[model samples]
Target chain A: MASKTSSDITVIQPPRGWSFPNLREVWDARAILLNFVQRNFNVTYRQTIGGPIYAVYTPFMTMIGYTLLLGVLFGAQEGLSVPYPLFSFCALLVWTLFTNVTQNATTSLTQNTNLIQKIYIPRLVFPLIETCMQLLTFAIAFVVLLLMMVVYAQPFLWQIVWVVFYVAVALVFSLGFGLLFAGFQARFRDMSYLVQTINRLLFFVTPVVYDSTLLPAPFNTLYIYNPMALVIEGMRWAMLNVGEQPALIPTLSAVGVSVALLLVALLVFQRLEPTVADVL
Target chain B: MKPENAIEIDNVSKVYYVAESVTEARGRARVLRNLTSPLRRLRATLAGQSAFGAEIPVKALDEVSFEVPQGKILGLIGKNGSGKSTLLKILSRITAPSSGQVRIRGKVGSLLEVGTGFHQELTGRENIYMNGAVLGMTRADINRHFDDIIGFAGVGAFLDTPVKRYSSGMRVRLAFAVSAFFEPEVLLIDEVLSVGDAEFQKRSLGKISDVSRDGRTVVIVSHNLSAILSHCDLVAWLNKGKLASVGNTAQITSEYLLSSTFESDTLAGEKRFRDFVPSDKYPFELLAMRTYDDQQHVRSSFLNGMPVVVELEFKLGAPKWCTTTPSVRCIGCVGLSRPICSIRDRITSTRSCKFTAKMC
Candidate 1:
């Protein structure tokens, strides 16, 4: 055994801030993060009478609501040659995935305050995994949508592959928004209430409940700036063949904002990362 | 040279500013007005401020520095609010110090409370894994040692039960099991062994002793002098967050005990402590008590085997019999919980008599 001096031992001065700057350390801690995410995923529906059935129940309820409220009451606002039930179902699927994913991701760290305070892990991983877990639930809902479309005898063309692109767009939008708000909420805390209120108002503003194209000109162009608008509109076009292709400008603008928001959120979160523990 | 001193705390100081309640500082008129109504204080507190926010600076730790030589156990002893827990938290990385530096040599496992890292919703079996991982154990390693952990906790029957369902004693048992089962380079414990039944406490101490024997450094923060004396090799006596003394356990403990006893003398004994043992003869007679060193010089401190003197001041003629022997029991010499020892001496005095004897 080699004799050692006090200087030889590395004293980990209490790390400041939230970011795990050490790539090697973060990489080594992957198993721990994975385990934490798995534990949360299990806990969400574990031992409930409904069990994993809620994964089915959530989107099924949304689909039923959309059929009655939008399809029958409003008479299919998008004016697609497609049936009202299929059109409304497609919009509900995309909207549920985006909204639920963002809500769960942004608030994951705040809700698990005890674990965050006691232990140190890659803080970013919490929001990221939260996004993933909710997406897994969304995927279940997506499968239900596919089965419904098949039952209605909608043609399964190669164009159905376009659904993946729409899902990707929604996820990118959520991560961008979720990360920005997660960091903001950690500081101000009031942002959580604001986000919830906005999420409620967002339903009417977006193309989910009623198609945005039904709104008169100028307003439709303006509303597309809301990224979820382009995502939901694109989903309707691709999945239910509704409201034409929605023009390239709106789709391009959605992609631009998602990318820009993601960059800014990552930068801001990294900057405010340290001293999170002290503040919380 | 001995394993590079597992813990080296250099110039670490933690400062907490003490604050006073607003009610205490308010004027006489305000105090009376507040006493007449409780709703106003609640309203004031709800307005995002409180009287307790008024700053009164208290130095919880002041430039305290020490090291636990690798494989050596160190005891931290102090009075209430003397900065023992603050120092331990800084060393264990539970919280950051206001200033200064700390260097830890190896994987440091700390148990500052009975269940500092337990997840209440998790089952006993699951928490063992979660806690082990937090303390730096890999999954495969925990899996390999799972049986050993279950056996040590002795909670095999309830391993699948949620930790919230476990009694406090059961929680400590499982907590100690998970912590003790893991082999880390250094262990930091803070008064957790005081939990659980006496038999389990003994087992926990034995486990700690085994860890010490295995050449892993251990630093224990405790107010129990006997526990420290019996377990630790070196001790640092903290006073007002500074090191008052540091040396072998025997020397530091004896010094601490003597200082405490002297401090206790100034306190007017409590009315509840007024001894009135009705006897056949003279009920009870007060005595002049003086402790001395082995050299027979009048000294305030009596080390182990030194002499203690109890001089009595009494009146001889009374209705009760005068043949009763006076018994003296001095608690808190070792600690407040246990008596050091009791001394019985024959009492015969016209006015008063000074009783001098040796302390074992």
Candidate 2:
């Protein structure tokens, strides 16, 4: 042990306005970040028989439901370039990632009320852990999507590398909304229900079940502004060479909007972080 | 600001704005309030009225200021809801003070509650690492002391088992061991040590002493008087969100004990004479009485073989000479009441008289 010497002093007081979190302190606490992620992963599948296989199974079941509801019932596959299951499953991949990440992240602080009250770790870590945990599930579901694509013999295009960029967009978009809802959820609790309602509404607005081409001109133009629409459509255009490929200008604008939303989300989250424990 | 001081708390206060209706509001009212409060505030804002609504503000800490010198063990003694935990929370940076500030030198390890973030599904080893990380220990640091922690907790045999399987005592021991090894420059401990078996408590206390002796600062908040008396170099007493006293451990502990005894005495008196109504025609009236053990501590029940003392108080109507006799009645397990003993005393003119009787 080192000898007692008062070299560095940490001054604490009530937060007044927006202050950036100590990123260096967070970096130094990488072990805690990893532990949180690991704990969430472990606890999610603790007593389950299927364990992590359920991650893939959930999306697989959802894909079947969407295919039946949107593809067969509505005959929504008339305008798609690939099989209905492949296109819809591709959209479901991004949609599931967005919904799961945002939902988990929104409730992260409230769900860990015991830890929040008892200890001081960077509050951002909770949302980040939730995002990463959902990302892990998305990775598994992505593998399942690839298997389905092979089974359908959908031609894999060279543009598949662009899928990484779309995935990044989806991650940022989800985290941005997650942080926003989390700040309100910490105090309000009703924000979670609001988020769920919005997510359900968002599924219809985005090009998840039906192709964007099925929509009229102005609606098609406006739908890409939702960010997830562009991401899901771009992902399908890249991997399956199906769906209308969003123009470069609109895609770039959506990415810019997502990044801007992420910045705002971070600022709002930081402003609310200090008082989260008090409210809880 | 002094280099020798490890913590400088400057007039720090914490205030919580609580909704008074939260507890009493029924399901529909709660849902309505939750749904429409924001819209109402927005409407009020648009109408140029202040959006802040009515909320009851409770001050948990009131401008409390104290400093802990480097390498000293300071015990914070207070009753429940007396701001001891609030002060510790401010120090740990879990919750910020509403006003003023707290300055601490170097890293802080706060064990506000044992097994704070322990997930029941995780194995003991995993929880140790997770908890150690939460308490601000690096992975390498935990790795270095991993075996020592398991050995100290005596949970090495069950290291791979989930924490939910362990008894509560074993869980507390493991949690304490992980926190004790954190080795931060400043340590804040709440009443976590009061849990677990006596042997573990002793070892945990010894570990605390070892930490302080190694030239680190430790601030401990506990209700256990003996533990505070034995382990602390300085004692700070908090009463109702304010610092009541601060001094040497021995002196402060004795004063705190004396005050607490008086408080409990009054409390017991109130309970004993709650239904006693004084008559306007009497020259004197009995006020209150209670039993006490030999150690100056109040006792509500006495063992059959033990000697007991009964103390009583009476208010005199006028300052006239009076002879008062006090009698005791033993109530058996059945409905029968039997006369036990009686004591007689003659007193000169006085406004009040207090006397004690020893019963064999």
Q: Would you estimate the TM-scores of all the predictions? A: 0.77, 0.82
Residue B209, candidate 1: Cα error in Å is 2.6
TM of chain B vs. native, candidate 2: 0.69
Among all candidates shown, the one with the greatest DockQ: 2
Q: What share of the true interface contacts does each candidate keep?
A: 0.20, 0.81
Model 1, stretches more than 4 Å misplaced? A1-26, A81-94, A105-110, A116-129, A154-189, A233-280, B1-3, B15-60, B113-124, B158-172, B254-261, B267-284, B294-299, B302-335, B339-360
Error of 2 at B25 (Å): 11
Error in Å for residue B6 of model 2: 0.8
Query: Which 10 successive residues of model 2 chain B have the least lDDT summed?
Result: B330-339
lDDT of each: 0.69, 0.81
Model 1, residue B204: distance off in Å is 2.1
For candidate 1, write residues A1-280 as lDDT tens digits: 1222223564645334343244565576676666666666666776698877787686678767877887778677455677776776787777777777677767766776665555445567677777777778777777877888889888766656777777888888888787777755664566677777777888878877666657888886699878888877778778776666657887788888888887777755654443344345
Question: What tens-digit string does per-residue lDDT give for candidate 2 at B143-254?
Answer: 9999999998999999999999999888988988898787989999999888778888898999999999988899999988788878999999999999998879977776
